[model samples]
Target: MKKTLIIAIVGILTFSCSKKEAEKNTEKTDSTNTVDSINTARTKINDSIKALNSKNRFRDFSGSHQFVYQNDSSPKYSGSINFTKIDGERDNYTLSGNIKSGKNSVTLKGFAQVVSAKHINFTGEITQSIVDNDNGKPYTRKGTKTFMSKDDGKTYRLQDMVNGSGFVDYIDIHF
Candidate 1:
């Protein structure tokens, strides 16, 4: 009877030890799986960010254009505009230029920020100046000629959102 009781106690101890070991192994496996999932998610997020930056790099807005002012059938004035790319979350250009006809000339300064794949907004507010085409009576021209434009890679087709029938004299900036 004593021998039988000892054998039974040994068997129970063995079974209990095996069960505890199995539980420990399962905990280790669960922890490893969680770590692997976190690493995979982090890698995916980094790849997505790199792809976004690469796509934006091609939409660079940096160049120079010699602009000739045309009033009626003749080129009344001449000037140059230079667009310099400013690197940041927003893709844009700082514009600095002028239009000159002999001794008389008008200067321009502003910035244009990309609003779409083919559109940008211009803000000519450096000087806070305005031009009246003819006399000071009609508020014809302001520091900002066009608020928006269509950008087709090479050139910008200026859009005067404030154009009207009475607006006979207009400023056209093609680049």
Candidate 2:
């Protein structure tokens, strides 16, 4: 009877240990899987960037667009602006453009960010110090822009305007 009791206690302890070991293994496997998924996502983003680089699609881009600024009391003002994409870094790009406003030409310097293959955001600080060619009034604007692409990375469509109390500027690009 003493031997039998000892055996039963040992059996219970062994069973409990086995279950704990199994639980530990399960947790380890889950952690590994999460790491693998993160790596896979990083690889996919890298592959897309490589594809864009192979095509030279992002190098030296130029386009023309019409910009309209919305105001509270009056109809919006519309004018044309041109953009030139300068190549330096993937995260940031330079832009040079002229925006027409009330017979004035506003010079623009823009820096753009590519958050991912599907998202593009840009912010530009404009010098309103330009002498108005017609009205002789100085103009200034400061704004940020966001654009999204449904495609992998081929084209970027404007999303919204934020951080500026000036105008609703629309840019039309051909690429």
Runs off by more than 4 Å, candidate 2? 1-61, 88-92, 101-107, 116-119, 127-175
Tens digit per residue, CA lDDT, model 2, 1-175: 9999999999999999999999999999999999999999999999888766544334444466554343243344444555555453455566555556554444556876666666657788654322312233554445786667666545555555321434443332223
- State the lDDT of candidate 1 residue by residue for 81-124, as single tens digits: 77787754446679877766544444557887776666666777
lDDT of 1: 0.58
Q: List the residue pairs that clash in candidate 2.
A: 65-172, 69-168, 128-139
Against the hidden true structure, what lDDT does model 2 obtain?
Answer: 0.56
Candidate 2: RMSD over Cα atoms? Answer: 12.1
Give the candidate number with the greatest lDDT: 1
